[model samples]
Target: MAATNFVRGSVLKCSFPYVDRPSRPGPHPHYCLFVDSFEIRDRIYYAVCYGTSRLDEPLLENHNGAIFSVDSSLIKGSPMSMRVTHFVCSHVAVIPDRWVYRNFQARLDFIRPEGRKGDRLRERMYDQFVLLEPLMEYEALIAVNYVRKTGRPGLPGETTLR
Candidate 1:
């Protein structure tokens, strides 16, 4: 579509995690958010649109809807909050389970070595699942096959994400 289609009012950047691309068409004029909320798609996607000229931009920010509050976790050890990147469609699409697994697995290097790697896995799985989970049901089945059968267990129904 077009940015004018949805952002009729203003360019409010949410706190969603965005990936940096190498480069793109000069002044492609894309919106980046500082907040995290996938549901915002229903309201904002109309204004955002792109294709191959997509400028290698993050297209969609990777946010897993963190479980803990940044303020609550900021005391002894942990930081404020966590950032989870879900490699799923920004709008909607029929995605395969393997695709979801592959998507996240590609982002493993992106994961920071924090104290709780398990927590990060759950966050990544949840975020990715939120976008692809409802569209398909092979996640659990594929996960099992990837783990027990493959001799490599993953986080719940999530792939190893490696």
Candidate 2:
């Protein structure tokens, strides 16, 4: 699919940067929701909220649904909230075609109200609209398999070395 197809309320997974210390080392691939977009000249960027899966945090599991949230901080010591946390909706990025992975394992449609809070965050995160890569079958398989067996996508710090 074209990057244009990724409209508001789209749920996705990518190598999202840290909220506070975005450049610092941490998780590579994080689940995110598409909030809003803007165009700077001819390029576009999407604002997204990086997700968390800290064991000590509260969680909301919408297994059958396409979207969900957790209660943990994206920043290490931040106070816990009712929504997916410890994390922040602070990414303005253009997902390249090579990095796009189609996750047939999960497909979601989040309209207004259902994802109102998240949409607001996304709008706040970015003001530029840009194109992104389409999903790759192979990458989707890796993610799907992991979610199928583990009930979640693999996070940073988890060894892929077998």
**Top candidate by TM-score:** 2
Please provide, for model 2 over 1-162, each residue's C-alpha lDDT reduced to its tens digit, 9 standing for 90 to 100. 225556543555656544343323234665555444433334443344444554232222221111233323221222323345322232233333233344411222223334335665433322211112112122233333333454332222231210
Model number with the top lDDT: 2
Q: So what's the TM-score on candidate 1?
A: 0.20
| TM-score of every prediction relative to native | 0.20, 0.37
Candidate 2 stretches with Cα past 4 Å from truth are 1-3, 19-27, 55-162
**What is the C-alpha local distance difference test score of each model?**
0.24, 0.35
